[model samples]
Target: MAAQSNAATAGTATVQGLLSELAALEDPQVRAVNERHGDDHGVNLGQLRAIAKRVKPQPALARELWATGDTAARLLSVLISRPKAFTAGELDAMVRQGPVPKVNDWLVNYVVKKSPHAQVLRPAWLADPDPVVAASGWALTSERVVKSPDGLDVDHLLAEIAEHMATAPQRLQWAMNHCLAQIGIELPEHRAQALDIGARLGVLKDHPTPPNCTSPYAPLWIKEILRRREAG
Candidate 1:
């Protein structure tokens, strides 16, 4: 019991030190993140990565930091978290607690999908009524389709996209559209079908495209990414 108490105290000190580093690095002028995610600590990805490297992976400390931290600290917590340390209930609470869309993206991609527990949680998240949960589900689906589409019901996924893409909450719509783009790009058998859905829905049509990047309009996005891959 003494050993355990000592370990807990050590973890708390480590997390506190990390939080101090983040606060020291915070830049109030980094308002672009605030515009994009409604939260910003002025810490860039590079700084986050550097801090993550310093702290290493301390999943226990991560949970403590997340519980008491602000947006940037939460981001740091996720960066240093180990997927194996969390239960499904804990993951669910973390997702809800980190409500910003950018944070959700990080949690789904960096934490949940990488966890051994992903398969057990994916379907439940998809079926959840919460928009963020459903969006995380779609993000998981997107990762699955890209990495392994073997047993996935292509028809069912397409049907879901066609039916719900228009009315899905903003974050979910982004994810669902990602599903459409992934289908069109990754699975040859589904490409034509995904393209058809894109043409019909005109997903994100007129969303501005940067000079070098492809547009997010689904059909064009899918086609361009595929073309680039082929060229490379």
Candidate 2:
């Protein structure tokens, strides 16, 4: 019992130390940049990744850091936590927490996608009332649209996008647009429909893109990616 108590105490001290490290790395300029992208953290992604590299994977530590509600710590937790260790319900609760865009994106991409529960959680989140949760669901669906699409209804997905892409919330629209692009890029039979729907809806058409970056406007994005593939 004493040994277990000591171990727990040591874990607490380690989490505190990591938190201090993250705080020290924070910068106002970094925070401003992240804020523009809808994230609240100030730590440079390179620095956060460096910290994750030094810290061995620890599920308990990940949980503690995530509970503290610091964006950078949460990002680190997503990196260090064992994805499959989380229960389906726990993942659901985490998504429903509506974390900032970067954290939510990382949690879904890095953690939830690897979970055995991903397929199980996908539909529930897709149907969830919360737009954020639904956006995550769409993100997962977009993955399936590329990697494991035998069971998905491509027509129905396009239908939904056609009906809702123009009016859905920002995050959800982005995710749905991604699914549309995946369909256009990966499946030849649906490419025409996907492109048509994208052209019709015009979502993200005016989104400011950095120089030389592909536009997120689905029609342009689809053509640009396809053009690159043809060039190579």
Candidate 3:
């Protein structure tokens, strides 16, 4: 029993150290945890979550960041970039910044790819009143929204996009293909619309501009989606 207790204590310290490191990790937070240099930048997400589960449950840094919404909080609340547990308000701000490419990149890569809170983000975003914010709702819905066994009211969403597609071609194009790549066409009608919109919008096209040279796969899907729409 004594030996077991000693082992547990050692493990606890290791876990806490790991969490603090992740709360500070940045660059590798993208690319699904930067396989080659994960150790250097920070630990991978799966390990972070597991360790956090065992440690004293602290409110996720994102929750505090959302409540605070200050610059220092943004820098300090590094865990907001992680999928572990995101505050709803911060999620709203990220989505609101949808029109900004940098914000989009952060939302898709850091927040969506790394975190599971996307599930919580989808529905609320889908219902946003503003088209730009609603565009983000569609954008993330395709990426992180968990597929429901019963299914989503995707037709209404598509109709909503189509209604605005001509006027807001660029945004509509991005949102549709975003869904297409992630959600796929399980629903034949939605898939047909998705492929049509995605292909028309150039949903799969690559862009000459890159966000970071080290990580080049930035927003090609959106470029392609737009291209297809322009051609059609």
Candidate 4:
């Protein structure tokens, strides 16, 4: 086990060196990688994303990257590299990482680049004791419903969400807006759950409005989903 840890560390070092070098390269692709790694090489996170492209989908990185990404350095390991899948053990660790707007950033990273570890990110993310992490879990749960409808359990997930609404209203409200922004997010059951939450919150009437949208991206979508809920 110690040897494996060493190997992982060595792999990370190698990747880091490669990324640093990649960062200095003039090529567009290399610069993009640098930008996402926080290398401000005249490119924004959005643009670098278009170029770096994740090597695989998530669940693979759950063990190596997702669970351990709390540290900026560790997260950087993933910015330049990704695991193929998440082990059962890593899921528990991911629960410890506080979810927030940055959590969404990683998801976008995993999604844009295509990490195989996306599967394990949420169940673990939401179960976290931290409301922020739970908010992140909610973020992806909403995304999963859209991108992979057959993949999630809306009823159970929402029940858990309702638990958040009761206990962590701030986080719950923040997640609500995130759910709205993802237009193509298409899990029918999950979408229904989001709408249900919106109706209860009365976003249209400008009442309390499903907790305050703490994250910048949450508002637009929160309003949109509420509109959809009312229209339907």
The number of the candidate with the highest lDDT is 2
* Per-residue accuracy of model 4 over 1-232 as CA lDDT, tens digit each: 3322332333233333323433433366654665574443332444334323432223333334334443332334345444334343443344344233444456434442254555566676667666655666677666676667574555666565445453455655656445543422344435555555645544433434357542233334555556667899
Candidate 1, overall lDDT? 0.80
Q: List the residue pairs that clash in candidate 2.
A: none
lDDT, candidate 3, 1-102, per-residue tens: 332232243234332343344445334445344434222233344644443344333345344443443322332234333555656665667656444343
Show model 2 residue runs off by greater than 4 Å: 1-13
- Over the stretch 71-105, how does candidate 1's per-residue lDDT look in tens digits? 77788788889988889888888887777766777
Clashes of each: 0, 0, 15, 26
Model 2 agreement with the true structure over 1-232: per-residue lDDT tens digits: 3322322332343667777777777899999999999899899999887767767678888888888888898998888889978999989988877469999999999999999999999988888878999999999999998899998988998998999889999899999999999999999999999999999888999999999999999999999999999999
Q: Which 10-residue window of candidate 2 scores lowest in summed lDDT?
A: 1-10
Model 3 RMSD in Å is 10.1
Better of 2 and 4 by TM-score: 2
**Best TM-score goes to which candidate?**
2
Q: Please, what is the TM-score per model?
A: 0.89, 0.91, 0.44, 0.47
RMSD of 4: 9.7
Pick out the ten consecutive residues of candidate 4 with the lowest summed lDDT: 50-59
**Residue 123 Cα positional deviation in candidate 1, in Å, after optimal superposition:** 1.3
lDDT of each: 0.80, 0.87, 0.48, 0.47
